[model samples]
Target: MPLVRIKSLPFDHEVPVPQVISALSQAISDAANIEQQHIMVTWEYLAQSHYSHHGQVAANQPINTHPLLIDLIAPNFNTEKQIASMLELIAHTIAEQVPIAKNNIFINFTPAYSDGVYDEGHIVEWDM
Candidate 1:
């Protein structure tokens, strides 16, 4: 499973949050060759007053100045190519949905050991 967390300023009224989430989840699943049901996505909106870049608050900067941060946590089994594809897919997916530039979207991939993940009341085993 890949758990994706996206943090950004609130999207415009024209952008539906649920649609973005669904698209991101589907992209990750396709990139990783995993079932869509195994992918988890969460979005957190940061208030413009609370977000900053180079000490300038988002409210004071031009629109889309603040970057969109994405955290992708997954098992440590994917190849480098897979990781690259996932990052590309994620950035493109968000850029298409939101007004942010593709360059402003930053995705951080964190690898977790199979034994470290807990689900369904027990630790996950990749080999199982």
Candidate 2:
């Protein structure tokens, strides 16, 4: 359930996605004290001028010249304080590319019951 998803801003500048991923993996692993194997991270780009969701600016957005969208998902649930901390860990991973405006980033943590999710199209673990 500890998954880190990172999506970069839609900029022509080729972000060292691999380097950034390593940094994120390290940060999240340290913060959660968990192995890197359980973590999942991804990066996607969105043009500032051409991207808008629900008539509103999307999360992990760029407010200026097409900022990058960086998202980190963990096995956390409920409350802004928790989300904020997780975002900080993730933001620290790519702090070089993102500013600490608090509004420039977004984070989510959903605790999925292992039973609710599947592996190889089978409910691997549903017993308590």
Candidate 3:
């Protein structure tokens, strides 16, 4: 299972949450080499002013410096190439719906215990 969090500067306008969720799930599944049904993704939009770059507020600028920040947690058995592929897919997927540049996207992945994650007192299993 994979849990993903995406944080980005607010869009010029609103975006449908369902679309974002679907796009992310598909991209993450491709990147992480996992079944799409097992991936979970959530996102938030932050004002540029809420973040900083080199001690300067990004919101004061006309352009965004750090447009996207992604946090992902998943099993640790993926190969290096698989991880890289996932990041690339994530960036491309977000860019297809947002105006952020791929270079400005930042993603961090955490290795998680396969059976440690639980919801409602039941352990999450990779049954598929």
> Superposing all C-alpha atoms, what RMSD in Å does each candidate have to the true structure?
2.1, 4.8, 3.1
Q: Pick the candidate with the highest lDDT.
A: 1
Arrange candidates, best lDDT first: 1, 3, 2
Each model's lDDT: 0.81, 0.57, 0.73
Off by over 4 Å in 3: 30-33, 60-64, 125-128
lDDT of 1: 0.81
lDDT of 2: 0.57
Per-residue lDDT of model 2, residues 10-92, tens digit only: 54445577777777777767876767876777766654545564465544444442234554444324256866766676755
Q: Which candidate would rank higher by TM-score, 1 or 3?
A: 1
Show model 2 residue runs off by greater than 4 Å: 47-49, 53-73, 76-84, 97-102, 119-128
TM-score rank, highest first? 1, 3, 2
For residues 1-128, what per-residue lDDT tens digits would candidate 1 score against the true structure?
A: 88889987765545688998998888777766789878999998877578878787764223457788899888788888887888889888888887778888879999979889998789988862
Any runs in candidate 1 off by more than 4 Å, and if so which? Answer: 12-14, 60-63
